[model samples]
Target: MNVAVKAPVSTLIQQAAGRIAPNWPLDKLIAVNPYWQMRQLSMHEVAVNLSWLGGVHVYGDVSHYQHVSDDDLAQALSALGHELTVAQFKQQPLKQPQPWQNVAQLADLERDSEREISWNDEVVHQISQFAGDYFASQPQTGAGCDDFYAAWLDTICHDHGLEILMKSKGLVEQFKALPSDATTLVEQALTMLGVTDEAQVDYLHALLLSINGWASYSAYVGWQAMLAGKQNNVVEQLLAVRLAWELVLWQQLSSSELQINWKRQLAHSNQLKGEHQAYVDGLQVWHLANEMQIQQGLHQQLRTPLPAKDNAALSLQAVFCIDTRSEVMRRALEAQSPSIQTKGFAGFFGLPIAYAVGSYQRPQLPGLLAPQLEVREASSGKLATAQYSAQWQKFAKSSAGGFSLVESTGLLYLGGLVKNTLGLGKAKVTEFGPLTLSKQGKALPLSEQADMAAGILGSMGFTDEFADTVLLLGHGSQCQNNPHEAGLDCGACGGQTGEVNVRLLCQLLNDAAVREALIERGIHIPDATTFVPGLHNTTTDEVIVLSGQVPEQIEQWLAGATEQASSERAKLSASPDAKQKARDWSQTRPEWGLANNACFIVADRKRSQHLNLGGRSFLHDYNWANDKDFALLTTILTAPMLVTNWINMQYNASVTDPLKYGAGNKTLHNVVGGNIGVFEGNGGDLRIGLPLQSVHDGQKYMHTPTRLNVYVDAPKHAIRNIIDAHDNVRWLIDNDWLYLYQLRDDGICRYHQGYWHPVQ
Candidate 1:
């Protein structure tokens, strides 16, 4: 390849690699919008692009449209002001595919059709296995290599098994002729494939989508690097490796006739880039109609006029995460007594911090933001003993000792297995202690603590009111033998329990010096006011007090609240005993983690407090009056709202296209590389997103595939200003990734093209 042509090829490679969104690993797993990077394009464009590139669907199948009542479709069309009739819309073509197969896929279709093994499958398997070893939690024996591409090249060149497995005699020879560096390899591959400049991006992207799970995992490495103010080319390198595979296949299987077919396919792919307008338009209209119907139901729920402001002094005020699951607890808690009030805030409670235990550290805030503060565990002999025991357990489970240990301890493990199988074993809670603001061997100043306390208080709209005992309840879920346990935890806390952040915040708020500093800053904390930390166990709807001494009255209120909330949740769950579900090792559907979440309301809780949202809406308590200049509102829209949209879209995409977006059958999931991701039935591209069991219960889908409907209580102008200022935010709203609505005293108004239109 000529050096002059390398620049554009590299640019194309970079652009192609940008299409893959990051997939956080199992331990710190968080929901990510698979199309997040492509937000710059309209949702319709993405649907068309993905359809042609990978045969992926971006909306519900044609059956969904057929099943939806004609009246609902007509009303949805009317709501969106579309002129298309239900019959005409139904007649519109279903998702179409273009003849745009890559070299590996083409080879598999033409040359390897008679073979027992597919060339494409072999390529994905090889790459996925290499990725697993290269990024393994514990380094594999032969997985060592500094550069991603270089290691792959070295591994493939030496691996004689690949030639035998692929059943191609010249495969290793073709690989051996490849260039040393990723940039050079990519350039050469494009030149040999005769991929035109117009089609290079799409071609590269298609190659990546073939192994999307690993591509997404590599993108996560790059995402984390970028977050830390650095750049990582792992995604580009992985793209090059994928492209190289195509080049190898092209070399081994190409014929004069096949060469012409390849050229035609590339050209056709370029020509078909924007050719699905009719189908895409129909999808948009249908999706909007479905969303409108859901919105109408929510509107009815919020139709009751807001009750007159309650001035009665409260015995206690409890704050919970704005997560959809928290809505049930908050509602039930308030129902315990009129005097008891509840508020919702982001799960991490506005603390940008990471939690550290000995040698291990992880973020305790949303994935959108990097941790600025570090909270380290205080020295304790009990913690030391726990860490030592954990290390021994880790050693026993390692590849080297696992078989021997299992053989020796087979009888010893029987009792525990029986207990777990019978739902008698208690969930093991990791014990760690007294947290301090210490980063890199130094304790942070008291002023830093005071600053954090004041900022969170202000953002949470706690500037004016104070309760004698305010319980800050963070949430987590309990389940046995679940690799995706973190998925059930607080996403805003970076897929960890909110216990660390909430406990740390309570300590700061209770500090005498922090209180003195707050008073000086014009925010008053009543001396009698005590901040208590608690954990809301979503699995059982029980509140576990972590540190503070709760008032007798407040304890009684929490007991009543938990019982009522558990009863409400039991109706939706398979088993009435929530505790048994948590303990059951075979319980694939443990409490439906954020399954039906479709709406996010950023307004005072009073706006929808009386309505039973059925644990579907994420309620972030916001009082626009307290937020002068709309700074807090801007943060809410840009950060928390964006996070919720990611969560919503993760579910939406999983439900819409589970094969491409969701991790397959939980029963077949084999955890890849310890924590990177899972592989269904041992070998495939690493699975990402929620497993099928997370959103489906065998017969029916538990989650409705609705795009997020965000209801914000703010001036239309303020919402417009925020949207105008942020290009990504504008893309999400205007492109219909999610529906945005302005909550008003009169009625809810939907946002479209910089204007707000009132709902009927």
Candidate 2:
């Protein structure tokens, strides 16, 4: 046990100090023990650090070491469940008292109050001398001490996860020595299983043949590392990192091959939560469960309460939602709405208005100019003087020629209603008000929209933003293109294709009118449709951004810049055929799909294949040339409609509310005119893997569950109305809705409140 000095022990101690000081005062211990030092440390640094934690408390004073004989020291370590190191026995420190007061004084102080003192050159000199003298009187008996140290190391290593590192190292060495052609087919299978490296091919090939070969190999290496009591390398760290997947896969094969009860193994794995190997253990359980279809029996249950309001005047609660997905908006309402009162106010179009915080809590209304009113005021001799008239002429030039005739009429009505609601007198009525709209038709500004919606909701007594916030909380990706225009619908919601067409814009505006007029007729919408515009960022050499600038300024600047940029771009151009080729390509690729569903009929070979496409690329890749073909695709891709149809088929017509699901008295196939099952797709392809893995001793595997989609085909208006009314409709209150559908098994479907909860 003649230990040779390698690197100065102080160097090793300094490194160890970083790790231990965060938890305890290691620096203070070294400061007092001037004689207890060694030099030329190696990879044994970690071991030395760990060992210090084991016995430093006993070395309180140098004389205290004299009281304990070598045997006593050995016995003390043995009592604490550790073996004395061979190096320590052969090269033991002198059992003599030195400047032990320095150590005593420091230890006596409270842990928090102990201040660290710098180790001067003089202190370093004393420690170096003591380290040499300390190891001068040991015997040359390495075997017994080695055995004791090895045993002690194993115990400590096992407690701190060092055992796994040992196992991984041994496995790597063993695999390197493995013969190349020992198991060709097994290796081929492992390669197919994702073990691609040539170096690992032989090992993996051998690994797959035995169900627990990898696990056993890893465990053996861990045991060896524990015995050696050394720090592990990179390869040795694999057990804790990927051990779970290996364990799970191994268990999966074992239970399948040997017919063993793996449930106990799965449960036991969960207890190893703090262990580095826990992930491996969990993976094993997860993989086995997937193979057994553990989630198939679990069901989702839904419940919708009846509507009840506190105030009669504001008895009906309406939610205005503007999302690209109207169906999701509808589903959200239905899932959360109560039975008695339905949420209302589902509309999208409105005149653009800017909002600014006004005096008091009430918003100020801006009035529109009516030529008739202006003439009357002039005739009544209320006209301004010559100085005012000169200023008024300038103002009139900047006012966009007052408001449109139609807008003036709408504004007059809106202003009167708002004035009456606010209890404002005519004397306070100014030329400007909140209800005024921009002469050019466009959706209201975002701030104005939020404020107006808030006002409308305020009148109903819902002063909190929670409900309105919920109405706005839908999924969307951020778009930053076209600072002035937002990309809305784009055929997604049966609306306009783009800003290029004024017809589509007019359609949207007219629809807004229809909705506003509906409210005027006392037909309040409880579920409001929300409009969300997607944004895109377009950057080109000629492009220049003037964010927050007025629209007029942008147009004026662009008018001058466009001509120059166009001329410059025209200079570096391709042949005319190249342009024609692009144009031809664009014409071949149509943007719209049949029935406004965004599905397309591409003439792949003139038979005209139809695809049920809606989102982005559905038109190009999948579309239908005929209505019948489109219906087939709809049956497969849209689950909402498919599930609805299935309910219609399985139920008796007389009992249920047919209108709720858009079903008639006829059977599902009769109503739709055909039976289709192509939408189910293969179960394996549709499965989304469960987010868990399992491992045993150190192995893992993954698991997944199958999910399906359903599609429906309906007109735009009908679909919008359906989505709007969904929140209040009680799809469950009628027993006939459930019984007729024969959906008793809380298995395939579960009824929580009012809608069908599809089990995944």
Candidate 3:
């Protein structure tokens, strides 16, 4: 339930400022108030100021807020070029303050009541006891993916608040005191208790922080109870926190009400936790087994229709394939398989084939390569089909699940992903896909692929319905060659024979191993992709094929789309050019300006029922678009919240507030392109571009809060600076940096190969 506490705009700031002062890093405070207008401000302005106020200093520089409001403070900062006149402020003189006026103040004034001190000692003791118990109950084993539980033990401990409750406060303080030391306070404490090694210590410390965040939420719940003059249910509160935490962790978005379905959550926990734990354990064991296999040199026969030696001697023609589908898959395949060969009749976007393998299977002999096959789509008056070769009858099958190398009819093969020969020298990675299994020689089970795919799908905000749609779309066995007409040519694999294997390349995106490699190598992943598919009416071509050389903004759109979808709210896709504009802001920090274009007032489809509630059109005209012909983009951001209620009808209703979560931030970057696209800057050229709603360079609270340091490496159309062309830059920004680990210049960031790492 949302506590609808409103406050005088200024009052909210004052209260939050006061309450946050003692706990916040001074540097952060200063940075947040860079404009430092002491006079009047609007409610929207207040929201912008407070959005990241909590998580900034914890991860970023904490010394940004040292000075209080003062004349000298303004002058000293003006050296950096900032205006501080009260005339810059705007107030709507809405006769009186809103009803929830002073709620933050109330919390600030009643701080003591909010801080439940009664269970402090008890909570600490219980935590310590649980920690001891957790450590003591160990070394148990189970078959089939339930053996190794050590890897995630810290996560479990932290989730239960048993890892750091006893000494979290003191540990954080000690770390603060010894800021120069590479070792954390938790490390020192554990070392004293005879535990050393950096990885283990890091793990333990992370465990503490994880628990500390939860403990803080627990305390907040208690405070809320005190404010309400009644005891709140712990189960409900904890469940809410769990659901909310999951949302921020996975979806990177929040809804208005922010309520979750408890029944669903409970069911999910019961179904997933234990099974997931077992999978992790099994993975560890599998890894160990795979190592043994590699050491012994292992191999597996590809399933064929015929017996052993029958197809052995045939001159086999192998055509290397590349799958340049998704960023992640493309990168992964490229990184995993990088062997070189000829470019055959592969389509513009499909895998690059060296040559079409001709089919001819024989008994007690290998299949012979007849001739390269030329595959073409059937159009009007074109040959629809062909017949098999008579030589293929020479091969027969074995009942023990045997395999066969069959000779296919000439030109039975289709087009694949091949690059022009000219771009080889500029390619970053040449291969992808783990053709060779891991040292453990373990293959990802098909069953596990479904689960893993689901996880990935969830990350992209695919509803059950949406996922089904995608599956159905891809169900046909016949592969189609999808061309990327967006002028995105592959430089790395642009030659007659593509140099970079796009299939392997896509998998390297955000692959743990790839990320580790990049981090170790110290290369930055360029945030770039092709387009952002909107919520509704996203073209099948747009959904699958990203045309044009990969643009940074398109990548951001992909990541943003996935993040938003996870949250279960619909978002319209920004144009490819609009995405580029957002990417441009990454070049420099943002300045305060009216961002009219950035904020879009999209009609909420979920709440269309409430609009014109009294009319027949309310029920009849439920479609988001009224049959108007305009490019449509749609996406559901934020994950579904599992909820339950005593009232069965209300139980499954989504917890949503269109005014909050559905509301778009109208900052300079967003509004500049859509509305006023002119701003006077220090440079000689007048800055005319799309404005971003909020400062894109500021800290993003996604994934534990980190500063988004966008570097304008190189822009094709050179201006003095990226921020100058506000109109052009509006459509150039990349919001998918989180998804890209490797930056490939050939307009493709293939996954599974190698990816780039973000700067810490």
Candidate 4:
């Protein structure tokens, strides 16, 4: 049922540019794999092309790939079938463009000429203003993401025509009037600008390269059009304006006699040598080697007896997100007591709901998903009391405003600030609290809740195994002055805290009426078992009780989790002052933020029970035997596996090319539009991915940029059926974005080219 998009080459380029993700607001920050949609091209190919034409360092030359680990080098040589040794690498020519050929030299075409304005600056600024208005005017629930380009094309076509350019060389009329639609506009503008149809793609690439951040941001909104087999008109708007500007600028600089051949220059710039191919091979070898190391390690732990596999009477059972952060906590908790059991599920717990508070609605699920339900926060819980001050809310939100207000108060503010700094002063917030059962208010009807309960239980393979106290745990972080706070939270919850989804699901599952309906559907809950809602603070390493009283033994067991968390934290950083750095507002490195992540296994615990994952694997609880129809496995492959891949590549791109993809030095980042995005140094482009500090240490990268390795303990045919059925899944695996492994009785077998290759 997939629709094919039939378009001209010019339209294709615009659509491709528009498919790139835009950086979200600081509050809704999500990890995005920059090349997810462009998986048709290999990483090296994309990197090389991006660097050559865009002037962006997505991935550097042979020397850049040399940063791979020693083990990775050994693997690269064998897997790549390329000749690369230290001697040969030394002989390799530089992969990047020479100093003279670079586009940077094109800035000042004629030094002697008196130019009143910069064409690039003026066009970019004007376009940025138009883009901002177009996007900000529409809400997510409205047509804002798509209307910018449509409106621009319609308005411009009404006044401007080719006659305006025939009369005046000025860009004012060019901006004011234009052709009726994108195609006519682009064709006419190119004719006037002296750019031929053959060079339009290169021209579009050059223009998009300059304002890549804004273009990418606009593309993020255009995702809806791409999904519907339509081109992103907004990106076309960008292409049109910038292309028109080029025509006007060419007219202005016609007298300069600057011999600028954009097509010829770009053609020479994007060429790759045989040695550069070897360099790309070596980089892949390192990536493959890194992947192999994890697979071998995970395969080694396959036979370890899984806890609570049978219908054992467990004292406590807690379900946590399949995030890599939860893997360690699950292990620590299980080790605390033999009776304690842990299960990994998607943080949203199967209900795709947008978390809303009255008039304010936020996208709290995975940024990729279209929220199907709305869960509102009505009551303030405890914070709604009279003691809460309205001014304190503003103080908590804005640092500059709060500091100025406190400075005006002088001594009165001094005493309070000092007390707050000492951790004694409390400014109660009358907003954003724990979601209770009453607030849930049967969001999912009894039949719907019954259906969801079955899906959740069936996915986890928990049909009859109900514990004394079943805890649904979600995670969130608390930090000051951290713009990427949401990036540190649950990915399954759409970059927001997963506590609300977890609590609501727990309440629905524990309801007597819903349970009775589920029992008829063959899922039975024990009378003695009670479901509790909880949250895990990954930063502070604290487990907070949200609702329903827990047993005293469970409470005591939870209290000891802090010690285990500290032990894990010690392993993460050797520095004793690391904890102190977390409190430091100036510190950019809040946490590793899923660094060194490699494997995503959707199988039982026994597959990775004894191995020291080091918080690098995402463990989703799945029982293949229970999934006879393979629907759950299909969902996991398409949804969680795909989402995990995005997370993997986000870190990979950030580590490989921090200059372009990453938000440059955290110290220099200036918050743009309050919380919408960031600027590296006040102006150039919007900063998209994680800051450099999050991935790299002072010396080298903490995260090894590589593809995610996915291991599934399902029948080979089941895995194969879904992969063959879904083009998206097949594209990712076959395209080498991720590796798929089938867990068999004999050993782990990798799927490749319609055959299963045994893991070496």
Candidate 5:
């Protein structure tokens, strides 16, 4: 193949590199859009780009062009109407998307489909496994870690991953000769590809895209770069090493049949242009338009006359994460206990603590933020059996113990598995610490603790007014054998349950010294007020109370609250099968994890209290009157609000293009390298985002794909200032990935082209 360079082909690689973000391992899974870096481009453009370059189908299934039901096809045709005439419409289901599978699937459909090239899947698997190990080889935190790339470069050079994989194939010498530094590595990779100058940037971007997840992880850690002005060296090094690895692999494949014509593929990709890109873009608009119409109806229906300036003092107040799943419970609990008001905030509750779970330190903050404080777990009182804990940990971590222990332990173990599998046994639950123990560490400084309390109160709109009994309600999901269990956990708490955050914050607020300092900070809590902690089992749709030493006057309220929650939930759920579903070992649809999320409203509870949001909106309570300087507004826009947009996009991509965006068919998924990641079937690339069952049910899709509709009740200038301050946010809004709405006393105004227009 006498392949010359394709076009100038100079800028694509760098452009793509800028767009990729990382996917965390399954244990610490956070919702992410796999095509996140490509968000700046139109869906059709991204779809076409991947198809030409990697033989990936971004808009449709690669297994085949997604099959549209006859009903869906009819509807589409009807929508097209005169544009696509009935007589000329030959639906007849487009031909088999491809005649071949696997390695040969890389052949471009629109280009030369006749030439089939063989790809070695086994070698690809081995390489991918090694890549997983390489990333995990270093300490979660390390010495001289100022630069991730610099640290990563050191790790790769010193590690045996590359050497081990190459030695058996007789490429150890060639691998060792590869440049160890990122700069020299990039230069060599570009030279190998016959690309130079600006094209080197394009080539580098393409190489990173080949293993985009790792590239994203480095960039993902440099998250503040999205808002900050500094460059992220770690991201640069990550991309460089990725390019270097591919270069070494390419050299090894040079003499094998597995070698692909690099220059030809690049040339072929560049030469291609989509004839129906505009049409595809147009077709995608209705889904977004439909979402807009639905949300507006709820906005109007849910709208209510504004409440009195001072919120009414309540018998009880509970705070929950602003997750869409929490929307239902908050609404239900309020109805069940009229005097018991409920508020929504981030699950982490402003305390970014790294929790001690066994021997590991898990960050209980959102993935976008780094952990700041470490909270250790200790066995005490009734839970003081450290010996039992050690034994349990060993059994849980050991694969042989998990299987053979049950086989040989006794009839009790053998019979238990059968009963559980048959769903006849009682449901098992994961229990945590008694949470009754408090740290005896030197009392945190009064100023720091007081400041934390004040911030929490101000952020949740709870200054001055205090309920008799306040509950900090944390939520988590329970399911058997689900690798993505962490995905269903609270995002604000890293990927763990919100229990620790709730318990710790409650203990901090309840401290007498903390209260004294909080008064000085101008946030007054009545002496009669006490904070209680509890959990809402989302999978079972049940509420469990873990009330500690609060004032003993809340016995009646607790009883009434639990009963009403159950009754209200029963009213909403069908057949009350949540518990059954939770217990089912192989159950796929484990409580509709963020399936229908659509709108995000950050305003006073009164603004959206009347409308039944159908668990589609993430509601965060904020009063514009209290936020005088826009500090609170800025934090909301940059953090919780931004996180909701991520959740929305992950669901959006999974539904719109499941095969390309989602980890298809959980049953076929094989977990790779312990908790590193999962590969679909045997091997290819590491899968990112939610699995298919998480998005689609067995019948039709449960989630409707839509860009996040953000409704912020604030002055237009305040919202505009926040937008102007962040370049990354502007990229999302200006590029049309999300819609921003500002609530004015007059009406709702939609933002477009740097201006606001009345929505109505």
Candidate 6:
């Protein structure tokens, strides 16, 4: 197919490929904003583009708006300065389709009656299967093939089953004759489709969106490469593969009349802009109103003045991650005794390090940053038993002995399965001894350790006035037979438990030499003060001391807090026993896992300690007065705020459009390529985002589909300065991806486009 191309096809291909957001694998599953690449565009503009390109819903449907009370809707619209009536808005029609449809979709519409399978489904299935094999953790057949497109082509050319499934006899021959290069294939496809210059990017993007699952995974590869200061073109290759399939279908089904009609439709669609303005505008109103209603409730809670600080401190202070789940625990712990002060910070505790266990090294930091240091077990005695068990499992799964081993152990497996079913099986625990922190395989110097300690304390505003004992509690969830368990773990720890980072931080803060170095710098720790490391099991609401001796009073406080928090959590779950919920293999909603998350408050705990946020707000303790130059505030906004936005958007997207953006039914999920992602059934695109059960209860949605409302206790000018300095922060705010509020002495104010207004 030697078709002449007129547009900058390569540039368009790259531009289209860049639209796909990265999907981290199951092992390090982090919530990603699906429209992150389109942040420069306004939400309304994105709504139009996504609708036109992929029929994606950027906001809630009209039915979702019914939940909002008429009075609330009126108040919300008034707050936004919109005059649309509730009746009129409710009557608005749904978004209509654009004429620009992918060729694969057209092929499916015109599929032969005899063929039960659709071309679109077959294409997605074939590509998904090939991608699963290509991107497998352990490479299957195409180990040496570095180019994804070339590998897929090479594999498809010999696969006779695809030809039969696609019901095309010469498909293999056609694949064998296709261009070997991605760019060439893309150019040829564009030229053949007669896609105009204005429509090329949209057409290419639509093609990628058809197989968005693999494209997202490919984008993750590019994201990691970019993080390492390198370049990757796997997304572009995936786009080319998608285009090739379109080319194949077009050639087989091409007709003079059909070609003319398709060209006309493409040009017409390109020309017809704002065709769904009414629908989009109505949706925007509803979206804004919903967010406003939530914002108002949050404001009501945070409006109270902070109480006077208590100078008399005894017992201990506990610091926890700013995760929404931690709010309940922190609130409960403080309610136990007035002597205990709980603060919130990022779970990694300001340590950018990776933890090495056995032969595998996992980064124990946020996904936004790479590991700067390493921590490993100080003793190997506890690891031997774990390693031996792992080796035995590996041997049992090996091809050489798999069947025989399974046959010999079949009865034992059955017994274990029965025990698990009856909830009699005990949870497995892999213990680690003391940890040693290092940089470049060498011990970190005392000065560097002190610098890290100072940075942690300074950023978290923990300078001055130390308690007799300070507990650093990191959190992790416990769930059995869940492939998406990492999603429930600490995202700040790159989807792993916060054990290593907290324990390592404790070691640094407790070091005598490091403390001496810190004293030389300006910060001082009392000789009587001690640092303790603990793990907050989010599933069971138990705080387990990992090391050192916590005082008896502090222990009692934790026990009381656990009892209260567990009781509160039990009301939300199906079963009253939290431990059984963690062990039950069939328990779909082990814990809500940050569902209903709506607001993030960056202020003193005292501002919100009195009011219950219903476990929906991410609380970070920050005192702007303590932070000079706004550096700490900048870090909080840039890192933790952005991470929370990603989480909020992931939930929003999953709720607004569950099938396209969410992993479908959890019961139907089949783990693909050993944790790459899940397939709803045997074959389809790899499902990304939370499952339906995560966001939806059996009867109704659990997560409110509202953008995150971030309330920062900083000066408006300081917040604006940070936003002005960072393009991403500016984009997120200016484009309405999230709402930023400034906490002032008078009241909370909203920030919009370099201006602030009393949040009505």
TM-score of each: 0.94, 0.17, 0.18, 0.85, 0.79, 0.94
- Candidates 1 and 3 compared by TM-score, better number: 1
For residues 1-760, could you state the per-residue lDDT of candidate 2 as single tens digits? 1123333423322232212110001000000101011112221231122122211111112221222344434443443344545245435443222111111122223223334322121122222222122212212111121222122223232432222422222323322232232123223323333322322322221121111112222222232233335422111121111222232233223333222222222233223222312222222222222212322221111111223333322211222212212222222223332321122111221222222122111001111101110001112232345336535432322112122222556867456434533445253211211122322334435444344443333322233222211121111111111110111222121121111111122222224554364454433333433221211111111122211122353234333433433333233233222222222211211111111111111111111112111221111111232333243233222322222222122121111111211112111111000110000121101001000110001121111111111122223333233433443112311211111111221323333334554544
Query: Across residues 174-256, which tens digit of lDDT does each residue of candidate 5 receive?
Result: 55677656656655566675553434544455555555545554555455344234445455665665655566556654543
Evaluate residue 468 in candidate 6 and report its C-alpha lDDT on the 0 to 100 scale: 88
On a 0 to 100 scale, what is the lDDT of residue 636 in model 6?
91
Regions more than 4 Å wrong, model 4? 1-10, 56-74, 84-86, 90-94, 98-105, 109-142, 145-183, 192-199, 224-232, 255-257, 266-312, 378-395, 398-421, 426-444, 574-584
User: Which structure is stronger by lDDT: 1 or 6?
Assistant: 1
Regions of model 5 farther than 4 Å from truth: 1-16, 35-117, 120-123, 135-137, 142-185, 196-203, 213-276, 302-313, 357-359, 378-412, 418-443, 549-576
| Model 3 residue 309 lDDT score | 24
Clashing pairs in 4: 22-217, 76-285, 160-177, 160-178, 365-493, 365-494, 366-494
User: Across residues 48-167, which tens digit of lDDT does each residue of candidate 1 receive?
Assistant: 888778877788765554446688888877865789788887776766645368777666656546655887788889999998988884331112233999988999999988777767
Q: Tens digits of per-residue lDDT for model 6 on 1-760? A: 2345666777888889878898888878888889998898887798877776777788988677676778777876676677778777566576655535677766666667574688878889989999988788433211223488888898888899877776678878878888999898888778877776767888888888788888888888777777667677888888889889888878876866557667767757845556655556667777777776787788877876677776656577899999999999999999987788889999999898988766677788887888888888776765777667867754443322334554788988667646865777775553446778889989888788888899998877777878989999999997766777888989999998898888888888888898889988899999888998889999999998888787787888899999999999888766788877776656787888899999999987777888888789999999888888989999999999989988988988998877678989888878787768999989999899998888877988888788899999998889999999999999999998998999877898989898998865
Candidate 3: residue 59 Cα off by (Å): 29
Residue 447 in candidate 6 has what lDDT? 83
Best by lDDT: 1
- Least accurate stretch of 10 residues (summed lDDT) in model 2? 22-31
Q: Model 3, stretches more than 4 Å misplaced?
A: 1-431, 435-447, 450-692, 695-760
Candidate 3, residues 488-591, lDDT tens digits: the string is: 11111221112222222233333454434443343333332111111110111122221122234334443443343222211212222222221231222111
Lowest-sum lDDT 10-residue window in model 3? 636-645
Error (Å) of candidate 3 at residue 424 is 17
Worst 10 residues of 1 by lDDT: 137-146
Q: Which model is ahead, 2 or 5, in terms of lDDT?
A: 5
